[model samples]
Target: MDHFLGIFVVANCYRNGIGVVRSLQNANYWYQKERDKQLVATRELPYNVDNGLKNMLLENKYRLSWIPYNEFKNIEKIGEGGFATVYYAVWDNKYLDADIPAALKIIHRSKKYSEKDYSEQFIKELKAYCDIGYDNPSFLECYGVTMDDVSKEYIIVMRHALEGCLRKNLSSVAMMGWQNKLTLLLCIISDLKTIHSKKYYSSRFT
Candidate 1:
């Protein structure tokens, strides 16, 4: 766990200070103003990451590798989040004759998000990752997309972080010196500043 994730998980909170996000409204707006706005802002939390990325790949003419589930070997559950489950797997690259370790994020369908809603959300998130990918080394590097055969759910394949999330290693950070903590916070602030400028916001940042 590192301070960088402090922003990684909630970088979108920067949307408020930036004019980048295009706000969408629904009929529910009449009953609840503030709450409805928040709902509209985050109506789709990307538990379903594939459908959106698929469309994006087509629209943008971008090609993201599609690896079948069977190619992932020794899959083991590592962690679970509100919207997705994380797994540790080794990607067997047939052409390269190499095994690549990766983290697979499998999004779970929720009662709150239908296919349309979640698909849009997943696309938004994938776009955000693209924005931060190579240009910003601090973010997770997404390799490709895959699916869980049994669940028919999509998975995001990315570089595995052996250290896990910062929350998992908070104790170590708490023991660090003031200068170090400040430096970490500075990194998070810098990342957040970038997210904000991109006109994206993650309501999960609180």
Candidate 2:
């Protein structure tokens, strides 16, 4: 219980710019603290943890290996969303055997959002991502989340999509013959069926 609440406490600190200078890294660090403590307790428990719970935790546990901000180099702004700006960055993964090209989505420094609002939104979005899980073929792979030490801001790390958005692929779309386009459309429709049946969002091709 302490560790669970500690996650939020650290998050609150980041949201309010209390002692932490509003760092997502600090908040993420505490979130992992709770997860690590829980994992330890689970291993020590006498009874078996339910397979469902175990799988769920397993799916989300990669956050424990949050990448450090300094590891990213040559960040190029790629896109922007309602709440965040996206960048393509080169990441040197200390834990992994090789370097990875990645995408970073940094939350906008909003003037209108209060600390509480930002904190709540952060938790909500993070939870959504965690619930979605990894290993889905249709979605971009997420590396993890981290914060810039100098900026005191959080950024989400994801596998970079070098081909760019579907709109950029429209020229190829126009070049395709009717049969090929039909096959592509049929495939998309099939994927859409799966997505709808699962009630999940995912990226797909036209």
Candidate 3:
């Protein structure tokens, strides 16, 4: 069982005297133990200035498992950025269960970039995604990372926006009334507030 769940069970036992004497102190101790476990897990992440990128990726919960580049089928180039190109692909989840209709972000190994320059940008983007994490409607869910054997490029697996970007959706739709616009703006603001409230800062695109 997951350690978090185990910790909850222990706390519950202490609270109701299921197997142990009912004591508020004991219940709180078990809860604190779980909190300490999480802190220890976090501390396990490497954080050296010289190896910042790799160290950040060491937190495997968000770092993800390796998938061969060939596993993704029907890849269609959707967009491009200064450092990476994005694609929509069908992910093969034979090894590990994962979501389908995923977005594949491939890094551009440009001649203009030195090893350090390319890695720094890639790491920055990856760290941002890991910080956002899973199960939030406002942010894209990042599944994992993979490497292209042929191209030798790093790939970031993420959730695909089926309707395309927010800018595209807004332009494609008919003119909206003030009420509709206000509703959309409010929703966006709410999501932003949630992100800001968290200790981890998220750099998100709609």
lDDT by candidate, in order shown: 0.58, 0.56, 0.61
Q: TM-scores of all models? A: 0.60, 0.56, 0.58
- In model 1, the runs with Cα more than 4 Å from the true position are 1-52, 58-63, 111-113, 171-186, 202-206
Kindly list the per-residue Cα lDDT of model 2 for residues 129-159, writing each as its tens digit. Answer: 5444322222344556667676655666766
A best-first ranking of the candidates according to their lDDT comes to 3, 1, 2
Model 2: CA > 4 A from native: 1-64, 135-137, 176-206
Best by lDDT: 3
lDDT of residue 12 for candidate 1: 28
Taking the tens digit of each residue's C-alpha lDDT, what string does model 3 give over 72-162? Answer: 8888988887677899998865533432577999977888887788777777777666555432323555666666667766778776765
The prediction achieving the highest TM-score against the true structure is 1
Model 2 TM-score is 0.56
Model 1 lDDT per residue over 23-89, tens place:
1112112112221121111122234445556565544332345667888999999888788888999
State how far residue 8 of model 1 sits from its true place (Å).
Answer: 20
Residue 173 local lDDT, model 2:
78
For candidate 1, the 10 contiguous residues with the lowest summed lDDT are 34-43
